[model samples]
Target chain A: MKVGFVTPRYGPEIMGGAESAARMLAEHLQARDGVEVEVFTTCALDHLTWKDELPPGVGELNGVRVRRFPSRAGRSAAFYGLDGRLRLAPREASLQEAERWVQLNGPVVPALVDALTRSDLDVVCFYPYLYYPTVRAIGRVPMPAVLHPAAHDEPALYLPVFGRTFASADALCYHTEAERRLVQQVYPETAATPQLVLGLGVATPPPARRPGGEVLGLGDRPYLVSVGRVDEHKGSVMLARFFAAYKERHPGPLALALVGPVAAEVPAHSDVVVTGVLDEQDKRDVVADALVAVSPSALESFSLVVLEAWTLGVPVMVNGTCGPTREHCEHAGGGLWFTSYEEFEVGLERLLADPGLRRTLGQAGRAYVDRHYRWPVLIDRYLAFLEGVLARGKGRRGSSERADQLARGRRAQALA
Target chain B: MVEERLVAEPEGDHAQELVRRVMAEVHQEAARRRVEGGLQASELAELDELFARHAPVGAKGQRLADVLRHVDARSFVDPVVPVASKKAGGSALKRSIRSATQWYVGFVAHQVSQFAAAVSRALHVVDGELQAIHRELELVAPGPAPVLDLAGTHRVDGWWVAPVLAALDGVPGRVLHGGCGDGWLVEALGQRGCDAYGVDPRVDERTSRVDVRAEDVAEHLRGLAPASLGGVVLSGVLDGMAPAQRHQALEAALAALEEGGLLAIQAATPAAWDRPEAPGEVDLAPGRPLRTVGWEALCRRLEVAAEVREGPAGMDLLVLARARGQGAR
Candidate 1:
């Protein structure tokens, strides 16, 4: 079976979470047996400016065919003012205004949408809901359309047009059950659509070498690591302030490493280390050797770093208000959450003092990953769901199911 | 060494232990800080957190009524919509459309408005009556009865288990054993080819062999699908309960059983409570044992087809009742 992905941008170098996840998924699907993959995206790389960098045409990257189209117009500067004014009364905005909001949130790749609508792929998957290609082509595409909303609780999510975007898709792919519930709560009319909480599968990395803290340029002092883009939007500033206060209260060699690509300036403090944009191996090493891996972002729809930390048998701490991160903690029973400074101090102290608790939490978290998020299990579920989608559009697909009754009978007799 | 071994074992629930302990400490500390006006949360956030748990019962019904009132108030169609528009001649076009459709829309809105108001008023009366009954119960009735550990305090025999197995023989649905500590009876029932499970607050899910849930017996029964169970057995839950709580458990058990289902009950006799040296649980229990005659009277009042049997030594009593309906054999 053949599958296609329609994303705003597609590449290995892009660090935007949603687009990076789409690239990874496309690559993984291309590697599988009997499943071909293609990508239809734009020539833009920089999301802030939306300038055309890559040559616009067909190319092959990692065995998947990619087609790039140039934007008719980069987002005009005038749209920002209109966006700020319309967001205040988003729900009451007129149809023309809402569509304009999506256009301004742009790389208005009209050719990409047009080319995808004419493609012969069995099913098409839209990486994210907020884009020009998706908002225009989702309903018009004749084949079954699967929307990977990657939605967050933000102002754009409430714009009246997104309601139509979510409702028009044949099925939805959510990062977490919490994300599914959040989307359903916003668009109650789409509750009946077929959906799957298919969180991105984490590819098992080879054993990470145990490097000391100096690998991240910090000495061999006990440290905690927080991953992802370090910016105000990602809560890096608050984390730095909280760490500064924690260091002042308990003066010691305990260091806090903010390890990722840095967007905003983190306040320079004695105990904090900001290692911006490490290689993948170094990133894994930093997460692997830490006392705890922390996800402080409150607006995440999916935090793959948490699962990556768990895959290496490390516990995590996250903001309690983030639905997806908190759900990972609750489901695995491997982490703690803190909404205030005092709770953070107390929680860190608890995790630091108890070696056995840390070990058990790490073990439990790895077991959760093994049981659900392993690639084989995820691949099977993904294929089966896609098959079901194809079957829904035409007729039933191939028989890939075991006779469950036979398995049940064997289980009963074995127990007997 | 033993504690270290338990802690180091991956099977041990260290995550649950640590989370419970640290959360308890953090809650206590946060509360103290809030009382001292030192909490860092915004006043609005604190107020929201403060009142999250303070809502009275039946507040949901009252909230529904309030929402209906708002809908009713807004149901009227306004013929005089604002003619302000952004496009050239847009204001004039909107005025013309409003004038053309005003009377038709207003006539339909009048009927919808009256219907919404009627629903709002009817809901208001129901909520008021429910609140009154709740207040009356609070004033007149005794507080909920306390549960005592009869399983640890007293010895029970398998005399009733055989009869229960026979009565529930060929039963069509699953069986539940209330107060099934260690789940010995439920396991035995399952071994006999009976689909059986148990509910006991003390049963550890990791160690128990049977499908025993750590929940209150009555609360578990209330969550079951109506007429889903083939049989239900109560042994120690009725040992020390107020009359109201006892009736509540009985009603829940009967409601969960299908037609022609078995309802087995066993309790210690009042004379059996003479053991003042049983445990502090018995000594401090809020209610005492019920007599066998009282059990018979309860069965009679509920119109249940029941048999009252005295244990061989007069130390225990058993009541076996069948939830019989007109169509049931």
Candidate 2:
């Protein structure tokens, strides 16, 4: 099967979960002998010249074909970056400028229509429905489109336009039960239907080489670590308060390390060691050395960092506010939950004081991840799910005979 | 060693001991019968009186025990007995057996019932205690509610502002409505038209769809994106959270919003009409009314948020969103 994947961003510049997932799906799908995969995404890199010119149509990355379409760079900029005009100077810009930006860049519909019409593909999978290109493109094309609405919140776009695209899609894929419920709640009409719950896979890290590392801030001690974008929603402030309370009760040499992109506004704290965006190896090191890794965010679809921490045999402490995080803890059996500051402090104190508990939880978490979240297992599941969707689509089209012939031809081609 | 010290301890002392033991056994049996006989006699008396009043005159006078045995036998013969004389006869028969058993068994059955009741009550208590422990574990556990992605979207049924506002009045702190799509409810409540602003992750200026990721509500709020809203309205966000994520979302909302602001929330009441095996999709269970015990338990643990009101329509129209030490408005 020749499959086409639609995403907001692609390749070396890809950031965020949906983009990473899209890339992974494309690569894995392409690796299958009887399948061909292509990725379609936005081409504008710099926000300033987004309006200047449309970029080239096609490029190749990691043995997969990637097609880049011209989208309003300024709009993309405003949406992606914090310093975009729409974000920083919303009050200063005139209504006309805003309207102009909306008009010029809002034509993702045309771009998507053009792309779908031009390409001859059997199945098209779109990622992160909130993006204009994916939503607009999927809306126009009537083919067997598989939508991976990465988060429930993104459905705000599809809810108004397609009126629950997941329900109408040939097949819908979700990461967690919590996310699936959110979508169902919004679109109650789609209840009791089979939807694929394909969870994200975690790569098992190589064994930890170093015995331990110094706690960066508290001078020669281990520390509890949190990795994510250092934003308020990620629970950095809540964590800060928790750490402070934890320090007062248990004055151990252990420190608290906050690693990730620091938001513009962070709570003023002395003990926190904020390392802004470390390399992959450094991140793995931090995870390995940390006494515990914490996720304070209340709104995660599924946290990759939590799984990564688990893969590294590091115990996690997740905020009880988010469903996916809690599910991770439960399934992984490697974390603790806290609803209040006092409770958080108590949990942290216990974990910090007892190394044995940490080791047990961490080992359990690693084993759980290895069992359930490996990529090879996930890839096979994905293939089976896609095949089922394709078969169902073919049934709907009343083209079983044609589908069989195509399958035979593809098999023959693979053999050749 | 002392010859003749006991001076003729009774000659037949062993025989007397055997006789006493036999007498004691008889006394115990008599006592047991007395208790059992008393109840059985009263039951028979009642049955006799009832028969005299209700049974046809000159009919064979049947003992209550016999009537009860007939009823038990009839029940197996016809499981779904008609509510006619026949059914009544069967019922009366069962009642007669119960009465006769009470009379014949005496206090044994009563004691057994009492013991069973006590055990049942203890088991219930233990179950409740275990549930409480689990709730505590859930509360103290870190992370947010699990996010359940719904398959579709539905328009909210109606506007519920007064009760929600009343609940918010009790919470003395700033509030944020995570996933405030289109700012409809916020604008309706005069939050957005006034000082309240929304921070959606999507960041679209023209439309209300802010692409705020589920995990990023706190991040946007903390950036002072909405600045300072007196109250946050998380209308349907809670239902979307996993048990853990729900806690995290609640904490994040409380943390980012003003200390004394209100958190006016409206969550779904799981549709009562849903069928069993409702798949892995969204169901009406999450929005059900908080049972008395469940509500109280939640209130006790969530010191920052209190359950101001909850009902069948709106599972919980809570108002107490202010944390302790955050003074009242």
User: True interface contacts reproduced by each model, as a fraction?
Assistant: 0.07, 0.00
For model 2, the local distance difference test gives 0.54
Clashes of each: 0, 89
User: What are the per-residue Cα lDDT tens digits for candidate 1 across B1-329?
Assistant: 00112112243255556666766786567556545654343532322232222121112113453333334434444445788999999999999998998888777776776776677678778878877888898877654343344333222345666777788887756688887776677767766777666766554432333455545665666544345467888876777766777877887677667788889887777766666545555554456777878898887777787898877767667799988732342
Q: Candidate 2: list runs displaced more than 4 Å.
A: A44-55, A73-109, A153-159, A162-164, A192-194, A207-219, A394-416, B1-329
Candidate with maximal lDDT: 1
lDDT tens digits, residues B72-182, model 2? 222221122233335647767766666666554656655665665565556556667876887899776543322221212212334355555555554432234554554
The list of candidate 1 runs beyond 4 A from truth reads A394-416, B1-21, B34-329
Model 1 global lDDT (CA atoms, 0 to 1): 0.71
Question: TM-score of chain A, model 1?
Answer: 0.92
For candidate 1 chain A, the 10 contiguous residues with the lowest summed lDDT are A395-404
